[model samples]
Target: MASPAGTTARHGDICVGLMSGTSADAIDAAVVGITGAGATARLELLGFGTMPLPPEVRRELFLVFDQAERAVERLCSLNVVLGELFADAARTACRQAGVPLAQVFVIGSHGQTVWHQPERDSTVPISTPSTLQIGEPAVIAERTGVPVMANFRAADIAAGGQGAPLVPYFDWVTLRHPERSRAVQNIGGIANVTYLPAGGDIEDVRAFDTGPGNALIDGVVTLLTGGTATFDADGRLAAQGSIDEGLLARLLADPYLNRPPPKTTGRERYGLPLCRRLLEETGLPEGALADPAAPFSLRQRALDLVATVTAFTARSIAEVYRRWLPPIDEVIVSGGGSRNPALLSMLRAALDPVPVVTLEAYGIDSKAKEAMAFALPAHDGLLGLPTNVPGTTGARRQVILGTLTPPTGIVPRSQGKEGQV
Candidate 1:
């Protein structure tokens, strides 16, 4: 099936986007068909697929993420391995969409973010702000036989921005409503928000990390379940208990919550170490919970801890809205945490009066929204356009983000690896 005329001289509108969020769980690949460019660009969601990381691959990836005594060999090997994983995801998504891989013009891989520092590191003498996302573009391009765009943050950092919350551009372009102010809140491992004023231009948008999302809550769940469970399924355990008011109050007082916009954080702040501390302080059982059937009193304590963390995440998000965001009618949510019932219920309670809705209301997959954020920006990149929201990232000026890795042209994309990852 050939594309109609004027759908670009070459590859038509098909493009693939790959995203692995702070959770390090699966690679989300979104196959989008973008026509025209910029705000007027029309988008079609052809297909979406999630490729779970192999357990061993995920473990090694975390070793580099959490441990200080990391090996360069591990980092080097994992980078290529992740690229292979990402390529597999793209292929799967394209096939699912009934689109040939070679017909897709480009792939936008946000890669796997191992470390991101929104603030400068004063310990280094030079004191330059920095961020790192691996899964090299060259590797993806080589393996998938497609042009790739990646390393989307470094350009913004070079321009003195925090290089975070770049998604505000996508929110403004794709989501801004005609008559009402809206907020797009993504509750990935790290929660972030984009506030779009009514009929907002690019400059009217404001965005920043609100606080911990599934990162802390999921970390605690993993601790309780030993290595068996990756997340609290549908917030079941949390629904069983009560929140510890005293602990919730203390966590709410975190200065990062009060910190202004142009901010971001990752495992460095709310990862395993914080979860371990919380578990130890709460006196929860450790080592394993394959069968969490415990003495009633002990089980109650564990449930309370889950409830407290869930409360903390909801409270922090609501606080950001109360303090920083201007009046808005709708709070549209996305990301993995949005699927957590307990989190959404608490969020709805806190943001009473303002309707809390999922991105599905707008007719898009909430889970694949971030993956699309990267894809559209890659389109803008090829068009030589700037998509970064200067106010959100504190960049001096709007600039194009990401580096392009053209295909090696050694093999046709359709002939690339099919079944194996």
Candidate 2:
């Protein structure tokens, strides 16, 4: 079907956005129709879906992520491997929206973040702030026949920024309210918050990573279940256990939680290593919680660990807000962690008197919010507009984000392999 004569003029071009966050849970794709440009632009979600990463691909990706002696060949190969998967996700999302791939103007891929060093390391010689997101945009362009805007973080980092919490640009554009100062908090693999002062402009925004989101919780659950569970479903395990105040206090002492704005973190800090350490502290070993028939005392210790970590996540976020942000009218929560009642209940208690609500209340699919965020940047990049918020990223100046990869006619070598290639 052909678009109406004024459809493009009125509703703008059709674009696709893709992201695989630190969790490596799945690749999220959003097919969005955006109209206008810059802050005045509007977006309508045409379609959205998620594609799970193959187990082997995720395994190799994590190996490279956690290991100090990461092989160049493995990183090189997995980059292309993930590109094919991201392309597949784009096509799947477009198909779901009944929009032909050929009609899509661009694809914005955040890729899988293998490692992110947002600050200089004093322990390592010549260490500078750097980051790597590994799904190759060139491959996505080749397979989809659509231009791709990727590597969005490097430019911000180049300008002496943390190259993170990029979604503040999106929130400042779309969610800022005239009457209310809102904290748009996303509890993904890593929790970050964008503070939008009531009726303030982009320059007034403050954003940063509060600390671990579902990463630590999910890591603990995955370890406990011996691969049988990837997350604490609806935060059931946490709800059933008792919070160990001593352990929670220790977890809260993490310096990252107290660090001020324009900062970021990832699986590099909050992933499996932290989970393993917590398990060791609890005197529980791997798969200790896997057996349903385990001794009551043993299982309770494992459950208590889960509860403590859940409190750790909530307290970190609340503490950060208390330490830095101005009094806000409300906190609008989103991401995978928003669905966890145990976490939410704790957060609500910690920040009593402040209304806490999900993005769903405002008519947005929480799962698709971050994936959809990249589409706006992609659209703005094509228009030669800057999308990164300097205040949020700590960049010296506002600069356009992403590198563009124009479409080519060649087929991708790993089209049919999934991750096997």
Candidate 3:
């Protein structure tokens, strides 16, 4: 239910925003309360929680994306499975927050992206920019008995946009400052930034992906440890190795990095295949990355590769600020990449005088920021507002960003009802 215009509404509604990033590592669910509207909307994060994808589920999802054109059936089945996973995560988050599931009227979900082609290329046969998010909204609504909104990126693409960097809308709403310009940079699997001009309006926002963040770094680490390790674990692996400047320079020369804003990327570009190609190009032993890749014994070549990829992530990010962005007075870092000391150290060096801060300093849980982004917009989207930022996604016009799966009269699931929503 929307409020009368120009009248400030208080006592927000309870809603849940579920996010499954490109990493497919976990389904993060945030229990949030949203009040007011437009720039006046205030977000109160009641609670947050995450649930790791089962190892088996993660492997199948990888199969769906790694060789997707050939794995249509896997892609089809995984959608339902991922939806179930999302429902469970939402329940867990509500329980953690002491919020009743029945009271959660809206659930905003940014489902797992199986594939994203921001442009039509030799590989992508689509006539226009396209993207797909799984975790069926119908399934989520049926399972949770709450109206759900998912598939956030497609509407922007339909309007001739990149359908990326939707978070800028959220960043501008929550993190914008009255006087100082801000760059809210989120480094999840892929790094992206939203530039907010000082005392800026929504149209003043600019954003785009800054190439790979943990996507490349994590891929190489998984290969090196033969799946024994999922990530560098606090940048320890990178800390021991020295950055290879020559290799970093070549990586920086990538065309994707040089491309202008209104751009987006995913596993399609920076996944395992890219890591394997880098290994071959760097002359790091022919079979070092064969099936069951070599373990991380901290060998000289492995160490160098790790350090090189890490530097590439950080340097590419800094390069974006240099190339685009308005005069930024502060940088607020969020997402998984912020946890990497080595990555942050390199970023600090690249941005020099501009102060880089964490989302925590602003009362946000860095890890849960993306989830919150979806949560706030879900509430407003239900109130009949457009959430996608035209400048960031290159949309010709603004459009409502989600498809809803409405809750019915069936008893709510949390009340021990044994039926679907």
Report the CA-based lDDT of candidate 1 relative to the real structure. 0.84
Cα lDDT tens digits, model 3, 6-40, are 22233366779999988888999998877766688
Listing every candidate in turn, what is its Cα RMSD in Å to the true structure after a full C-alpha superposition? Answer: 4.8, 5.5, 5.3
lDDT for each residue of candidate 2 in 224-300, tens digit (9 for 90 to 100): 88878889899999998999999888889998877777789999899999899989988987787899788899899
> TM-score of model 1 relative to the true fold?
0.93
Name every residue pair that clashes in candidate 3.
142-421
**lDDT per residue, candidate 1, 316-335, as tens digits?**
99998888889989999998
Q: What TM-score fits each model?
A: 0.93, 0.95, 0.91
Number of the candidate with higher lDDT, 2 or 3: 2
Give the range of the ten consecutive residues with the poorest summed lDDT in model 3.
Answer: 412-421
lDDT of 2: 0.88
Reference-based lDDT, residue 165, model 3 = 84
Clashing pairs in 2: none
Off by over 4 Å in 2: 1-10, 68-70, 408-421
